[model samples]
Target: MIKRQAREEDETHTAVQGCLRDLGKSLGYDVWIAANDRNRPLDGGKLGDGCLGELPAAVGQAPGADAVRLIDVLWLAKETGRIVAAFEVEHTTSIYSGIVRMLDLALGPEAHALEGMFLVAPDGREGEVKAQLARPAFSRIADLKVHYLPYGELKANREAIARFGEGMKPIQAIARNLV
Candidate 1:
């Protein structure tokens, strides 16, 4: 039962990641799924085959290239080649790691390129996300502002947002300001 529950949560994580990828692509951004996650099944193909072959040159050259490449999903402006947003999916794991990754990206030299940072998780996790962000260890994340995007909202609007939404504004409207 424990193992089954874990698998279910992991599947949810992948589904959320796939939703993010679709939204990014729909918004005309160059989506980047984490290198490690590129092979996961999505829409009848591997996510790796759906996203960029490599991290954008700009991000790959950044200070935290290694960490940056591992972000769950990144939406980069097609022309500017800079990250428009970064998302870390925290389905059943501790939220600390995802927040930490966002912090690293927000504070890195390419920080200037990031317009948004998000933590995607179950809707019930919003309160938990708030509590975690309130920690002193993540004080810097507060200043940078990390948004909490509940899976419920993302799943509900993924298709509409992909078909009708324009830019980050649409996504931002659904995600609550966490910090």
Candidate 2:
């Protein structure tokens, strides 16, 4: 049972990876998610991953800041050959508060390399998330883009799934989606 559960978790992670890969292709960017180990926090500071760039320390206290703190995904735009954006996904449970904290991190220097930060949430929640982002501190991060992708939308988008399956090359079908 434990093995089976682990396998299922692996499968789910694969699917999410496939989706991101597809999204990258669709948007024309090279996508990467910061891994905890590879992008380990530096000097016990509130920063991680020298891959994108350096991030400075936080300025002020914010609610639910720590819980929502996680390196989300990073993306580099292929067309312009520049780091386009980095985003952190916040599920239903994490929601508004999580986005706020992510905005705090994204607005820092590391994210400045990108065109903007994306707040990816479950469907029907983009509006609220956007509203929260409208706060003065977050609004300073110019050109921020908010993308909301619901689970249902992902389920219905067969073309996207197919594209992802094809684009994530070298890996077999199962591994492509799983990895």
Clashing pairs in 1: 38-48
**In model 1, where do residues sit more than 4 Å from their true spots?**
none
**lDDT (Cα atoms) of all candidates against the true structure:** 0.86, 0.45
What's the CA RMSD of model 1 in angstroms? 1.2
Off by over 4 Å in 2: 1-18, 25-29, 37-69, 77-82, 95-116, 141-143, 152-179
What are the models' TM-scores? 0.95, 0.45
- Cα lDDT for residue 72, model 1? 96
* Candidate 1: residue 146 lDDT (0-100): 85
Candidate maximizing TM-score: 1
- Total clashing pairs in model 1: 1
Clashes of each: 1, 2
lDDT of 1 by residue, 75-169 (tens): 99888888889999998789887776777788877789787899998989899889988888877877887899998999888888989998798
The alpha-carbon deviation from the true structure for residue 53 of candidate 1, after best TM-score superposition, in angstroms, is: 1.5
For model 2, give the RMSD to the true fold.
10.7
